[model samples]
Target: MSIHFTVSGLTRNLFHSLGLDNQRAPRPLNPEQSLLLECYLAGQIPESAWNDYVFETPELARHVNARRSQH
Candidate 1:
């Protein structure tokens, strides 16, 4: 048997493997960091929380960064 991942990159495939393809999967919002923006837009998170929540999970980091570049 074989598995077919519709995603087209190594990073993307890894993300799927990690179950972070969904928005609710608890992944980082941006790669470089969204500290100031998130704090201004929403609120601040604790230091430990930031460490826990912020990570370049799977395809999320690459995909999001790519899209941002287009704008």
Candidate 2:
């Protein structure tokens, strides 16, 4: 999903190749991935570990990173 979103310069090129509009969202990407993708695309995360976290062990990553309820 993220791959579909953050791939290197492939977005516009492929869109053009397939005769897709630059104005429209690409069909290859899902709605969920679009958020992180936009952030990544806009260079918000300078020291990004998003790729490793998601690809390596998403469940463990989420478990460790999940917010605990404060009492």
Candidate 3:
């Protein structure tokens, strides 16, 4: 007996197992948002300011929260 697995088939199976197959793609950050997030993650931005910015930017908040959860 022999078995074969195509790259596309393996990739699709992996994504499905990880629950990423149906999840909506993450939104890309704008230039300003990207800079702010980088600063925040690097501890250059204070928590107060980051909190305020996240409150006003739902997309950024989601990104931040996801990163936090990973750690």
Better of 1 and 2 by lDDT: 1
Query: TM-score, each model?
Result: 0.24, 0.30, 0.56
Off by over 4 Å in 3: 1-25
- Which is the winner by TM-score between candidate 1 and candidate 2? 2
Q: Stretches of candidate 1 above 4 Å error?
A: 1-56
lDDT of 1 by residue, 1-71 (tens): 99766647877768668856644333445534554334523546555554444362334344434545657
Candidate with top TM-score is: 3
Question: In terms of lDDT, which candidate is stronger, 1 or 3?
Answer: 3
Q: Return whichever of 2 and 3 wins on TM-score.
A: 3
Candidate order, lDDT descending: 3, 1, 2
**lDDT for residue 66 in candidate 3, whole number 0-100:** 69
Residue 63 lDDT in candidate 2? 28
Instruction: Give me candidate 1's TM-score against the actual structure.
Output: 0.24
For candidate 1, what is the lDDT?
0.49
How many pairs of residues collide in each model? Answer: 0, 0, 0
